[model samples]
Target chain A: MISIRELHKSFGPLQVLTGVSLAIESGKITAILGPNGSGKTTLIKSILGLVKPDRGVIQIGEQVLNGDCRYREDIGYMPQIGHYPENLSLNDVMTMLQDLRGGKHPTDTQLLEKFRLGKEMDKALGTLSGGTRQKVSAVLAMLFNPKILILDEPTSGLDPVASSIFKDALIEERAAGKTIILTSHIMSEVEELADAVVFLLDGKIRFHGSPTEILQNTSESNLERGIARMMQEAVHP
Target chain B: MRTTGKIIKYEIRDIARSKFVLFYFVFFLLLTEGLLRFGGGSTKTLISLSNVVLLVIPLMAIIFGAMYLYHSREFTELLLTQPVNRHQLFRGLYLGLAVPLALSYGAGLGLPFLLHGFNAEGDVALLLVMIGSGIFLTFIFTAIAFWISVTYNERVKGLGFSIVLWLFFAVIYDGLVLLVVAWFADYPLEKAVIGFTILNPLDLARILLLLQMDASALMGYTGAVFQRFFGSFWGISIATVALVGWTAIPFWLGLRRFAQKDF
Candidate 1:
């Protein structure tokens, strides 16, 4: 479980996160939905300790995430763009991660096999297509079998088959009781895997509850329409 | 230390795999060997090579180091999310970068010297000084570039700053120093001149190389004064210390910025 309290972050005049406090429970895929420039990525990065919050506190389980970085051991983060050293092949990336992570623990290679990255491990990251690179990112995120996985735009570049494969993997991880916090613009994907939903707009949490609740409140049947309706209210309000 | 080692291992692996370092290695080897082969008067060629090192090494270090740090940023960000110390990560990266540059400078220029018959009293000390100064410049400028990369959010801005920094030390600084000295001709400015030279790593490196080559005639008024003041051993020591200081301070500043920076 992760808890953030009164987190306020600003980039110059633009306030990305404004007094947003959230507690994400374990064993659920919490899909953080937001519009462009809505601070969803900032919020996620803040939790991953990638973006330092200007104010407030974050706690993972019971330990306060301050200057100590050891807690990040439990986190596997798949960055949005997944830029890596262009010279290095996929195997080099895997080895580099293994080395940087230090000490040998059990690593999940299932995702690698699922993506069939083993055959293409010799290919340099620069040569890979965007979707392939995303698959690499996904594999790295799931490899460590971290208790918390923070995936940014997890399926943006994936093909239908790869995306479905990824979704199935997420479901499996959820079944294994891992806390998954993912940000995606894809509502159908969110509808498929997200156990609970957290909607953010203008650096504030607009809605946080079950997907059905959002549908009921907005008088819509499906998630896409419900979210659209919610956005409509925001625009008018 | 173990984690630092592991990081360095992978980091070096990454750098070595890149074409940048390899290109550097080949360029230096061909240039050095080519000079040795065609250019008559080995000593003159060595002196000219020293001049080349003085001008080119710092520039290469700045461009390469800045580009590497900026490009490796995504890799750095990914590592940030892992359970690793920032200080160690930076130290590892610093060493990872510095080591290859040093090795390439050594071997590229070095193999030529060995092939041409190296000696302790003959051309060996001069070659050693060239290699040493080259290494120092690499470390110093790379540290500066690292600072630039970490301190700026935008890569273009960071690289721009790095270029300006390289220009200031390599070209502009000496001209400005000459202008200042000429302006203050009536003032007792030897100490001030030496102080200003110490402030710039390229100047310090130039002095080290020039003195090693015993070509102080080319060093101008301050070089003679520098020789008189510090003598040989003390001069080398002071210059070496200055170069070390230049390397350490910027790297430390860069490390501090990196530790505090958000991805």
Candidate 2:
């Protein structure tokens, strides 16, 4: 479980996250929905300890989020855009990561094979297309089989078939009792996967409940319209 | 330790495949041949060859090494989130860069020695002093590069500052020291000159190596003073200790700053 309390952060004079408090349960898929510039990414990075919060405490299980804590060991992060060294081949990257992790992990060939990346192992990362790069990032994140997965724009560049493949893998991950936190603007994608929805607007939590409950609160028939109406109301109010 | 070794291996591999390293090796090979032919390959050509290693190589190493460290900050930040400490990261980077330094210099200097059959049973102590002083000079510059890279987030700024520092060490430093000595010529300034030499790794390296070469007699009054102060075994030992300080101080500061950096 992930717990954040009274989190406050600012970049210079621009306040990003203010008294942000939330809990993410294990074995559940939570969709963090927010309009652009609404602190979604900030919150994620703060939890990852990449961004320091001015005033707050974050806990992953019993361990607090400190510089030395190995809470990161159980967490896998898929950045919004994955950047790799231009000359690095896929296999080279995998081997390097494997070695860096000290060969402690079981061989994770399933994700590579599933994504059809085995054939492209020798190709340079710079030569790969955006979709292919995303596939590689996705594969690396899941390869370690971490108990917590934090993915930002996880399916942004995927084709429909690849998207299906990703969705299936996420579902399997959830079934195996992993905590999955995903951020995406695609309402349909969120609706299809989210067990709980946390809607954020202007760095504030506008709504937090089941997806059905969120839709009901906005009195909308569709997830997209519900999200739009909620955001609009949050702004106007 | 295992993870640190892995980081070191990958860093070395990355540097080994760099275009600049390849181009540098090729260019140095051609340049060495041209310069040797121009000098007609004489021991009297120490000035030209010394300028290559002293002035040119240090300049290039500072720029390329600083740029490499700065350009990889984001990647380093990613690694920090893993199960690795700051000291381990620093150890890996230092070791990784040191490998390429030793190999490239070995190739550059060794090639000429091989072709010319450069053989001399010079003082063993002085020979060891020369090699130690040269490598220590490289270490000091590399540490300076790493420190600048960590202090500045922008690659261009890092490279710019590092180049300026290298220029100061390579040329301006000696010029300023000459002016000071000229201004104070009447007093006993031998100790002051020795202290000034300790301030710059390049000077320390030159003094150590020149003592080994036949050109020590040609360095005039300043050379005589250095020979008097640093001619003994204990004197060279003191200079080596000072050179080690040149490496350790900058490196320790750089590692400390990098450990505390948010990224």
Candidate 3:
């Protein structure tokens, strides 16, 4: 479990996150939803320790994040855009990361085989298509079998077939009792995969509950319409 | 420490494969070879080479360092999410960039001389000094460039600051010193001039090499004062310390900023 309290962050007079408190449970999938500039990415980055919050307490399992990076060993991250050294081949990148991570854990190559990335491992990352690179990102994130998986827009560039494969992988991971957090714009994808939804607005958590709870609260038939109604009520009220 | 080494290893490999680094190595190789082949006696060639090294190394190191950091930002963000210490990551990145560039420079300049052979014992010493100075400038300027790159987010602004800094040290600083000397002609400016030279790594390197070449006589009265000062053991020690400080201070500052910076 990852617990955060009173998280605050500002970027040069612009407040991106303000007093965000959340507790992410294990053995479940949580989706963070927000409009652009609503601090969803900032919140995620803060948990990853990529962005240092102005004031907050972030505890992962029993360890509190106080500048120690060892806790990150249990977490896997897939960025929205998988930018890598242009000249490094896919094999080189994978090996380098494995070496850095110390290879202590039993290697997980399920996604690697599923994606059939072995054939393209010799290709330079710069030469790969966007969907292929996204697949590479997905493989690296799952390679360690990390306890927590944070994926940002994991399906954006994927073809329909690859997307399904990715979703299945997520389902398997969740069933294995791993905590999964993801952010996506596609309501249908979130509705399909997310067990709980956390909706952020202007740096604050406006809603946090299961998708059914949001539907019942907003009296909407679908997740998308419920979220839309919530946004409208927040702006108009 | 092991993690840092692993990071450096991959970084070096990535940088080594780039066309720009290859071009850099070749440019220096050809320039050094051309100078030795046609620039008259060994002494004259060495002098010309020192002039080229003083100007070129800093410019190349600064620009390349800034550009490399800016270009690899996304890759850096990717690394940041890993279970790696930020300090180690910064050191790895800094040395990874500095070491390759420094090696390309040293090997490029040294290879031609090794093939040609040194005619005199003094010539050997002078060549070492010249190459040493080039390596020092590379580390110093790369560190400064890193500081600039970390401080500025925009690519154009970071790159522009790098160029302007190179200009100030390589060109404008000398002009300014001359102006200062002329403005205070009667003020017994020898000590002040040495202090000014110490402030600019380029001048310190040039003067250090020139003193070794026995070419200080060509620098007129200021050269005489420099010879009296830098000719001594203490003077060389001080200059070495200054150069080391130049390399360390900026790197420390850059690391501090980088550690706290939000990716």
Candidate 4:
């Protein structure tokens, strides 16, 4: 389980996260949905101990995430746009990552081979297409079989088949009792994967509940409409 | 042990292929040869070579090292996501750059020495030229470069700032210091001038070698004071401490900021 409390952050004078708090239960998927500059990314970074919060506590299970903290070992992260050194081959990257993680665990190599990355493992990372890079990123995120997975815009450059396979893997991981936190603009993807949704606007949680419950409470039938309704409610309420 | 070793190896492998590193090595080697030829194989040639090499060496170190830091921004984010600590990562980066730079210096100077075998003076010259200057400049600018990189996000901006500062130290700073001393020449300002010398690494370097060249007569009363203070073991140790502080302080801050930075 991951728990965040009273998280506040700002850059210079422009406050980003403002006393935000949220929680993730074990063996579940929680999707954080918000517009650009709404502090969704900041929230994720704070959880990972990348960004220091002005005020708050973040705990992964029982251990707080801080400087030199090893709580990162439990989380696998896939950034929005993955970038590697231009000269590194895919195999080199994988081996380097495995070395850093300190041991080899079960990676979904069969699926990766199916994606045809096995054949081109020797090719430099800079030469790969965007979709291929996303595939590599997705593969590494799941390679460790981490207790928690944090993916930001994971499906942006993926093909339909690859996206389907990736989603299926998330489902499998969730079934096996790992917590997943993902952020995406794709409503259909969120609707498909999110067991619950946390709606954020202007660094505050507008709403937090099941996707179906959010829609039902807001008198909206679709995720898009539900989000729109919540944003409107946040403005007035 | 295993993880830190892997980080070190990976950093080495990545920087080994950098185009800037290749360019710096070739350019400096050629520059050194050109200066030797221009000086007509005289002792004056060695002095000129030392001055130029020291000036150029630190500049190259800063530019290339800064490039490594900025270019690897996203990759750093990826690294942080792993189970590695910031200190280990920094050690890897520092050693990685230092190894290649040290090798390039050796190769560049060694090639020239092999072409012309070392006499007593030539060996001393080469030791100061290749070994001393190389290590001193590398340590000085590696810290500066890493500081610029971690402090700034934009590549062009950070590098541009470093270039301007390099120009000031290598070319303009001495001239400015001279103007200041000349303006205050009547006030018995030898001690103040000596004090001012501590501010610039270039000046410290010049004082080190010039004293060895036995140029105290040309350097005047201020020279005697400089030689009295800086000529001693304490002076060299002081400069060494300052240079090491240059590395330690900035590296400490950069690592601190980097740990809290949102990649």
Candidate 5:
């Protein structure tokens, strides 16, 4: 389980996250839903220790993040726009990452085979298409069989088929008792996959519950309408 | 330590594969070869090579180092998410850049001189000083570039700062020193001039090589004063320490900032 308390962050005068306290349970899929500039990425990055918070305590399992990086060993992260070394081929990148991670764990190449990326492994990352690169990101995220998976917009550039493959992979990982946190704009995807939802607005958590609770609270039939209603209410209220 | 080594290995491989680094190697190789072939004899060639090395190596190291940092930001971000210590990563990145550039420079100049044998013992000493100065300038400027790159997020700003810094050290600093000399012509300025030279890494390097070459005669009255001060064992030791300071101060500052940087 991962927990954060009183998390705060700012870029210059622009505040990105404010007093965000959240506890993400293990063996579940949690979706962080927020509009643009709502601090979802900042929150995620803070948890990953990529962006240091101004004030907060983040604990992952039994380890507390006090500027130590070993906590990230159990976590796998997929960036929204995966920017890798342009000169390295897909195979080279994979090998380099494996080498960096120490190759101590038994590797998981299921997603690599499932996405049929072996044929394109020799191609340079710079030359690959967006969808192909997204697939590569997905493959690397699961390669270590990490205990926690944090995916930022995991399906943005994927085609319909690739998207389904990715969603299935997420499901399989969740079923295997891994904690998963993902951010997405696709309501249908969230409705289908997310076991819990945390809605953030203006750098604060406005709502956190199951999809049914959010729908019932907003008096809406679908997850999209419920979130829209919440956004509208916050803006006008 | 092991992790730092792995990071350095990957970073060196990445830099070595770039066409620009290859171009840098070739540019130095050809320039050194041309100077050796047509530039009169060994002493004259050494003089010309020192001038070129003193000017070009700093500019190349600063510009290339800053540009490489900016270009590889994505890869940097990717690494940050992994289970790697930031200090080790920073050291790896810095050394990965400095080592190859320094090697290329040393080899580029060293190769041609090896082919054309040294005529005199003094010529051999002068050549070593020139190569040593070039390597020092490379490390010093690359560290400064890393500091600038880390401090500024915008590429244009970081690059502009790097170029301006190079211009200051290579050109403007000399102009300013000359102006100071002209203004203070009536005063005893030998000690003051040495102090000013120590302030700039480029000047320190130039004087180190020029004093070794015994070309202090061309520098007028000040040259004799410089030879008296800088030609001694104590003078050389002081200048070497200053060069080391030039390389360390910027790199230390850059590393501190890197550890605190959000990205």
Candidate 6:
């Protein structure tokens, strides 16, 4: 459902994504795996139109992403940090979103209850803890149930229970045929939730296939070890 | 428009809780009341009130608007990733800031004037220009601040440039003008001076308000040629156009910079 072609981006002199291309199919969870400075986030941000690429095109369905912001209507992005207006209470934040979205989506009570965020809706964003803030970000990302979900470090601050709930939600969304592109360091989570693995390093795709292929190529039983082996192999080969 | 309104709604919520905006409101309210009570006499109080409006409005607008953009950078980025239009996002931000700031100045200076019994037809017309000048300054300077913030990614550097810009207009600019006029005193530099006034938004505001308050105070300095020019409808209209130009130029520059910017 989403396609990226020759995506290249650089911050100053340092190149982030250099001539990278990939396609993310619908009805599946694709985990973008990379080390620090691997340009994984840059690639994701480019697709979300957050980080303007130095060169290339990103096509979602039949339309190319352009200056017209109507394209973003299909996207639900959860940034790594749940940064929000400081003094805005959760209700105000959500209401404002609803108004700006042109009354597109209804209330998202399920995720609110799943994350136990109903009680915290009245608190100002600045007053919330990091994990709680992550929950808020997660809810916002899923609030619209958009065509594609771009989640960066979606479970970093969540507790085990909350993480599991989030994973279950991801599985359920995949079942509903929504495309999800997520980046995370948690290998077990990736192994469980992601159907396809797109391994990136130095701004190029090193591996793109099923999760089982990643393990088979590296001859590693676990997703974590398999990824580590892939990196080591890239360095030597 | 509805999108702009909703964005403005959220921005107002944020600004409503801003410590600087709150402090600004309180400061003006107290300053106006204090000036009216202590300065004494209708004319003196009006002049004093007008002077502070000319000075403080632009200063606070620049400082507060720049700082607000910096502080709300995260929130702005958060909204940018949404389906909201960029133009609406920026227009809302500008209006959201400009509205509260202009209102605070209006209510602060306005209420005192109303209490002081200076609402005659002529006085109201003059009061409007005074208030209009204050609004213009707030709009213009906030636009400049937004421009600086948009151009520079670093907060300290952006704020540094913004403060220096304010200093140039508020402090150094007048010094440079005085030096220019003094050095060229032998020449009838009325045209040059008028051109110079148009260049500086602060000077343009001061000239408009000062002429309305006490034309004679400036008549001696501006002279008969300049006096006739400034005292006429054409002069006021030109100054008004210049104020609106000042408001539009920087705001448009800021919006352009914001449109291409990747958040």
Candidate 4 structure quality by residue, lDDT tens digits, A85-200: 77888888888887677665555565576567786688998999889989888887777778999998888899999989889988988999999999999988999999989888
lDDT string, candidate 1, A49-81, tens digits: 888899989999999988788898888888889
**Between 3 and 4, whose DockQ is larger?**
3
- Each model's RMSD to truth, in Å? 2.4, 3.4, 1.8, 2.5, 1.7, 2.2
Please provide, for model 3 over B1-263, each residue's C-alpha lDDT reduced to its tens digit, 9 standing for 90 to 100. 99899889988877877777778888889988898888765677787888789899999999999999998886688788889999999899999999888888888988988898766678888888888988999999999999999999999999999999999998898888899999999798989988887798887777668677786566545456777876746666777788988899999999999999998
Kindly state the fnat score of candidate 6: 0.86
Question: Tens digit of lDDT per residue, candidate 4, span B63-105?
Answer: 8788888877766777878887877877677767866786777
The CAPRI class of candidate 6 is: medium
Docking class of 3: high
TM-score of chain A of each: 0.97, 0.96, 0.98, 0.94, 0.98, 0.98
lDDT of 3 by residue, A89-142 (tens): 878877887899886767688998999888899998889999999999999899
Which residue pairs collide, candidate 5? none
- In terms of lDDT, the poorest run of 10 residues in model 1 chain B is B113-122
- Model 5: residues with Cα > 4 Å off, grouped in runs: B219-226
Interface RMSD of 5: 1.0
What docking class should model 4 receive? medium
Per-model lDDT: 0.86, 0.77, 0.89, 0.77, 0.88, 0.84
Candidate with top TM-score is 5
Task: Please state what fraction of the native interface contacts candidate 4 reproduces.
Answer: 0.68
Candidate 2 per-residue C-alpha lDDT over B1-263 given as tens digits, one digit per residue, 9 for 90 to 100 = 76678888888888877766666666655665666567664353444656566776678767777977876664576576555767788878877886577556656554654576433445334334444555676677888889899888887888889988988988898799899989998998999888888888887677666666647565545455777876745555766788889889999999988776654
Native contacts matched by each model:
0.84, 0.34, 0.89, 0.68, 0.84, 0.86
Candidate 3 or 2, higher DockQ: 3
Error of 5 at A146 (Å): 0.5
Which portions of model 1 show Cα errors greater than 4 Å?
B34-42, B118-122
- Give the DockQ of candidate 5: 0.78
* Per-residue lDDT of B160 in model 5: 100
